[model samples]
Target: MEEHNIFSLIADNLSQFYEYTGFANATFGHILMILIGLAFVYLAIKKEWEPMLLVPIGFGIIIGNIPLFPGLSVGVYEEGSVLNILYQGVQQGYYPPLIFLGIGAMTDFSALISNPKLMLIGAAAQFGIFGAYGIALALGFTPAEAGAIGIIGGADGPTAIFLSSRLAPDLVGAIAVSAYSYMALVPVIQPPIMRLLTTKKERLIKMKSPRAVSKKEKIMFPIIGFLLTAFIVPSGLPLLGMLFFGNLLKESGVTRRLAETARGPLIDTVTILIGLTVGCSTQADKFLQWTSIKIFILGFLSFVIATAAGVLFVKFFNLFLKKGNKINPLIGNAGVSAVPDSARISNNIGLEYDKTNYLLMHAMGPNVAGVIGSAVAAGILLGFLS
Candidate 1:
């Protein structure tokens, strides 16, 4: 009888312990989310696409979906948790501006300054944001939610997160994930659009090389850029201000250490925090829904529209220019702010047709401008919605 009681007590304790374990709380949704998180890590490692952003985010997803039994303060949503504190940066929308500062410090605007016309291509790419906005409204999303969703078209993850956190906090995770995923998939999405929109000759055409931009011009551009953009859209000050300030640090031929810190450790730290918290926000219950699916579809459409618009706009813009002065439509897809990746894609495709026609420098012009334009568009949305 005593042995039997001891065995019974052991079984009871084992069952009680299992109840407190993730195994007991795990659901299909949790398992599905964990698989999705694993997929993210797999893509990051094998594909080498945006690994810096994806790795932390993927791990965070797993952590967030660990199926806690509740009443524990360790979960992201639990009050007074460490993750809750880290998440406050994302929720409050401060992470994005800091990311922008790093972007500015690291970015070399010489490409854009050398060819001002490419800025128009970047501006044209923003058509997708409005295009998605209309579609989201028609699909019955609220104005604010639609606005947050529309920013995904910019292919700028930080901007997407910033606008969504402020305008539609509930959709921040979906919007951010959509934005970053599209950004990562730029190479896959943009090349087909480029080929469809341009002829082989168009892809082969290489225009005059960009002239050297003076250091003085480089220094002045950020200052003037900030003043003009901020004056026009003060709502963008948080992002735009930091962007120009960081650029000034780089351009001023001074504050090298400050610029290094902003671009290096500071940005790295912020990226990890923002990526992890953003991923955590997508807890299985909150993320796996019809709404997120709709957002994903809308985000895809927006990115396609943006990519197509950039390429088509370049083709159209070429009409007024003389034959030699015509811009290569292949670089048009770079106007969606995927940065060096989009620019590199233009170069890769351009090389396939003509090994001599290097489009990297030229594509960088619109690519960098897209960064500025996306931020401006976000501010416009903020001004209207928030």
Candidate 2:
């Protein structure tokens, strides 16, 4: 009888192990999230959508979703876990400044310097940030959270992450993912808005060549730009400071080694950490909430509004300009702050309308300006809301 009881106890212990393990404990929502993660991987590998970012992010999602016992305390959010340690860079907003450094190194400001007036187009597009802020507030988010969500419209991922980390750390996962996702979709999203807002004549219109910028202007731009922006919005100095410093390194002509390192290895490392931590932050329990859906909706609306605002602002500007000086409205779509992607879209759309109308160089002015504009907007919101 004792022998029989021992055997029964062993069977009961085995059954408890089977019942308590991840295979049995994981909910349907977890499965759904895992499948969504796999879909991201497919998009990254097969569709080539932001492959550098999405590949690591998708893989991280898969790693993050692997259900583990709470006692193990090894999940992304669990204290003392490796992922949680790595995620501190994101949470503390260190990754964004570094990413900005890389961006500044890669950026060429000659186009923007040659045509400073185009900076207005980038400024006009920022209304989308305020527009989305109001919308998010109406949807019942607090002012701080709303401010974070609103920045997704800026289509600037690092800025989104930076602002959201400060203003709404809880929503950072959804905000970051939404911002990057829309940035990757710039070609699809901006083209339709670009087409609908402007006519063929507007798209075909080409502006005069920008005045040649001097080496002095190139070198002075970073120093002057830094002082102006930093003094105006001290909160933005963390991002803007690093950005201009990196630009100075690139333009200084003597810092080629540092510039190359920032643009290449440093950026690549930050990107991988940003992607993985962002993905891991989206563990199903946190990301499956209604707020995540709301954030995604607000993000999409913000992007569309920013794009339209840019195109229409160009049309508005054309009303004042003589025909010879009028800017191409298509290039205004570059004001959504998706960097070269939006500018490239503007260029491609321009080519389709007028084969000879090369808008790339002109469009780059607003494209880089949008970067500055978005950072400023984030600082404004961070000041007011946070």
Best by TM-score: 1
| Top lDDT hit | 1
**Error at 46, model 1, angstroms:** 1.1
For 51-76, candidate 1 gives per-residue lDDT tens digits of 99888888888999999888878887
- Per-model clash counts, in order, read 0, 0
Task: Give Cα distance to truth, residue 111, candidate 1, Å.
Answer: 0.8
The CA root-mean-square deviation of candidate 1, after full C-alpha superposition on the true structure, stands at: 1.4
List model 2 lDDT by residue over 166-191, tens digit each: 99999988899889888878888889
List candidate 1 segments past 4 Å from native: 1-13
Model 2 clash pairs?
Answer: none
